[model samples]
Target: MPNATGGQPPITGQVLFYKDPQPLSAENHGGLGVRQIAEPFAFLRAAHAVPVTVTEFGVAAASYPIIFVGDERTPVAVMGVRQGQNLFVDQNGYVFEDYYIPAFVRRYPFVFAADESSDRLLLCVDRAAPMVSNQPDVPFFENGQPSKFTTDAIEFCKEFERQRRATTDFAKIVASMDLFEQKTVTFQPRDPQGREVGPVQKVADYWAISEERLNALPAEKYVELRNNGALGACYAHLVSLLNWSKVVNRAVRTPPPGQAVS
Candidate 1:
């Protein structure tokens, strides 16, 4: 994993599983249905990437039908959305329009997870939040009574605000880029069996891989990569707009390139 600034890389690992005790019995099943889970990953595996899995077994209420949004057998980055309304399975079996996002959901579109018991939704940090604090949760089993959810939510909001204050200007740069004008590309990779897979995403695996490689390069090499599209055009544009002027001027004002002036 690389820090937000694209610094201090850490080993990236696959997500293993995410499970809720709720039985799969819901009428509409929503996005947590087994079909959705198995299908997307079938595509990811075909693309030569590891798919997160739900490997463990647990009791699921027969009355509600087990809804496995994700499991231990395969781990994928997930954005959990809690729907409070019981859209109960319709006679036709599909959930209502309001149930799923009108269109396929793009990942990290929201800032935080929604409250299962409340109407308010949490957008993931990738959304418009100012900042979101990442607080690890204490493990709780099937019967565990958890009191920290509220506290954690508050802390997350606070940290989000703090980080927002720090990076507000940077965000402005992205906004100015007018990415909305561009048509985002997505890929439907195939499995070994040639079955199609994964979610409709912003870009293909090649672009994502290229971005990672570019982030690992030294500054000058990174510039060269950007020109070649090995890195992202947006990142290269940002560098031209900001760092080239501000960072270089700050360095020049201080002293010789390698020396600190007292």
Candidate 2:
């Protein structure tokens, strides 16, 4: 979807699956609404990684190897080793096992865009989304006010915005401490005989919190992190790194189309 104010880039860049994002308003979308879809999450099929708020580190840690990426140090849940595949989600839009679903996925088709002129947040939807219907069973508005479904969606987007702010603050705190380091996840091919074969493969490289630096911090600075709620997030991120093996193994089990399958 386009950005919140329409067509322009998102002020907040996590607009992962939105293709034609447009601000929701009674005048513009009085008749548009969403419908139930057999594959509500089909959009996630190609999204190998998605942004996650700091609050999600505790729960998302169990399912995704939470890693920091990009110049912004934005945290993302690694779903697939390759760029275009999501190992946990199948072609039919089925999520394998009981993997922790990120709120970013669940909040699809609806997002908040900032109105730069007034500095207000506007709720937007991906009009190109398969579930968005011109004649929706549940309309976006009723009697000139937002319908209950629309109201609920608005609340969800608002909560996500709140979480986004908190996550930004946490990232700043971590950056200020200079605790991030370059990290990589790799795979080594093996033969049927269970012996190592071929060259050691670098699956992906990104940023991660440095445990060594964290432990070496001054006592008062360490206490400051603990008091700021970042200490737990640091541990959560470090603990989550153990799951990188799972991502590598999954890529080996079902390598993307061009890659050699293990």
Candidate 3:
């Protein structure tokens, strides 16, 4: 967007995604461990391009159910024994291990916005879409009321870790989920004057992988991509689909705050 002085003014409120580079591990500290995962954004920050949030992280399988509420009201349950010890949830709430929290975030869409005052930003699941019911079928969190999935997720890792102990072959402790087929909407940002810059192409390319690869993705990985505007591809394609030049010209000619044709 342009300023009154006619420059490519600092972009305010532009949403960007920074891909995490490593698996969530004990070394970095909960959530903090994966903060550096999005290295590209680091480069931007060095150049004074601060992101509102470092939106996503990666983790292993068996952690998705703990971070999300399935469309099915009835939760998926698992139990087993280790070192002559019986590990179980006692038919109440599901128990998750900390190692998997980062991965589960990948399955759903999330948003991060800059706080403006400090370097730290806000991170949370997109209220527009949230954890689905984990019963009969998995689906999106219902309208208006975005579930506390992300909020619960933040603390879930700590609790899981506190209760966790060293044990080999945690076969019983590990669990997997079958998420429902779903669709999403993409929104391209406009310049300050509200001129649509079109979809960010690079973002789209990063997400284009085979259905097989997608199917193999754990829920957390899936949620991270989906949550971080997975629609970037479709959104970018819309420029060609809807005539990119025409849209840009229309925005320029509209005589708005950011669109004064030169």
Candidate 4:
């Protein structure tokens, strides 16, 4: 959007899956809005992993392995073993079956970004998103006021921000307890005659919550975790690791765009 001086407005921050996010405003986005698309989640096809909230651990465990990445030990659902591949999502950008969809993916196109000018978070949109259009079925504004769609989106963003903060606190608590361990994920392809052939290929290496260590912690600390509502998430993550084979199977079955399965 053009400013009064005919220059583009400043961008707040760079976020994942958001290429060109602009702060939502009635003045700038009055004519721009979002609409439903045939494949709303097509963007997820290229996302190998995405941030997930701690609260989603139990359900998310059934679909994908939740691992921690980056310095913050941020938990994420590992979608595909290969880079830019989401095995669950087909070429058409849709899930192959009914799976637990992360809230992060559900709230795409609309995200909350901190406005440097104000202490509060500002609602932003990825103007380049496929669902965003010049002629939108759901207008962001109605007569210079936020439409119901936009208001609901705002509420969703607010809740997401709350969950994000809670998830961050959970990570911090776990980190403080020193319950994480470095782990590697790998796969080996088998050949005919039921023989395992080819070199062992590494899928990923990440930080994981150590169940043994968690069990060894002081009783008071464990109680503290339980009280803070982190014990369940920790165990849920541990259990989710078993799904690594599921992700690997999908990866092996569905090779990269130009590659053949070994």
Off by over 4 Å in 4: 1-9, 258-262
What TM-score, to 2 decimals, does candidate 1 have? Answer: 0.20
**Clashing pairs for predicted structure model 2, backbone only:** 1-18, 1-19, 1-20, 1-21, 2-20, 2-21
Residue-wise C-alpha lDDT for candidate 4, range 30-90, written one tens digit per residue: 8878887898788998888989998899999999999999999999999988788788886
Better of 1 and 4 by lDDT: 4
Candidate 2, residue 193: how far the Cα is off, in Å = 2.1
Q: Residue 41 lDDT in model 3?
A: 18
Sorted by TM-score, highest first, which candidate order results? 4, 2, 1, 3
TM-score for predicted model 3 compared with the true structure: 0.18
The local distance difference test score of model 3 is: 0.27
What local distance difference test score does each model get?
A: 0.26, 0.85, 0.27, 0.85
TM-scores, each model vs. reference? 0.20, 0.91, 0.18, 0.93
73-187: candidate 3 lDDT, tens digit per residue:
1111111111111122211322223422222223223333333445433343332231212231322123322224434443543333332221111111122222222222234
Backbone steric clashes in candidate 4, count: 0
Model 1, CA-based lDDT: 0.26
Please give the range of 10 consecutive residues that has the lowest summed lDDT in model 2.
Answer: 1-10
lDDT preference between candidates 2 and 3, better one: 2
CA error at residue 115 for candidate 1, angstroms: 20
